[model samples]
Target: SQTIHQWPATLVQPVGSPLSLECTVEGTSNPNLYWYRQAAGRGLQLLFYSVGIGQISSEVPQNLSASRPQDRQFILSSKKLLLSDSGFYLCAWTGGAGAYGYTFGSGTRLTVV
Candidate 1:
């Protein structure tokens, strides 16, 4: 069975600070990884996606970035967080094409103060 894990369930940080969030998957290989951000009471917006190692695609140019260092490890980072950066960050995985649905990890809610 495939499972995903994300750390720091919630975070509070001052504006303009650095941000780093991690996600990892188990029981799967070469899965498509994605980072999505959901604003308060809004739908998710794709931030980045990785089809394979060192292969990242950015959906939006914002105060965020993503990287895939290992087959099952994905990371989201920001050099300087903005007030608008505060939201629910989610990491998801899909079994490439023909995948039915997404498997989302426990999300991290960030509050920029």
Candidate 2:
């Protein structure tokens, strides 16, 4: 079976700090990975996506970045965190042959103080 893994579940950081979030997909190959953020009560905003290794595309201009090191692993990082950079971060993947939609990670609730 295929599964997605994300970390920390919840986080609380100061106004300026470093952040690293990771996601990995199992039982799939050549998957399409995506990173999204949801504000307190707003819709989702795509931060970045990768069609293949070293092929990331950014959708928003936030201070966040994403990377795909291996075929099934994806990483999101920030050199310095900001107060407005708090939200629910999600990592999703879609590339199977079936009609199943994207499978998302458990999500990380980030709060920057």
Candidate 3:
């Protein structure tokens, strides 16, 4: 059996609080990882994507950062939470690039108070 790990399924953070969400894709190497944000009744927004270690691309100019420390690990962190940052966070992994190969995590629902 294969195992995957994702953290902080739900979070209630203050306006000025710090945030850290983690996702890992085990049993795979050099996988493409993506972080997306979706607002209530709104379309999805791609936040970050990493194709390799130390390589990250930002889709939107928002208050968010993503890091790929290892070949199979990705982390999303915010220095300080903002009310606008409240949304549903999704992490997905794929074998390089392909719409059919994408596998998403459980996702995190963050609400900034």
TM-score of each: 0.97, 0.94, 0.93
lDDT of 1 by residue, 36-96 (tens): 9999999999999998998899998888888899999999999999999999999999996
The prediction achieving the highest lDDT against the true structure is 1
Give the clashing pairs for model 3.
Answer: none
What does candidate 3's lDDT look like per residue over 17-99, in tens digits?
Answer: 88999999888787888998999999888899999999999998988899999988899999999999999999888884666
- The C-alpha stretches of model 3 lying farther than 4 A from their native spots are 1-3
Q: All models: lDDT?
A: 0.93, 0.91, 0.89
Candidate 3 TM-score versus the reference: 0.93
Winner on TM-score (2 vs 3): 2
Write the residue-wise lDDT of candidate 2 on 54-82 in tens digits. 88999978888888989888999999999
Stretches > 4 Å off in candidate 1: none
Candidate 2: which pairs clash?
Answer: none
lDDT of 1 at 11: 99
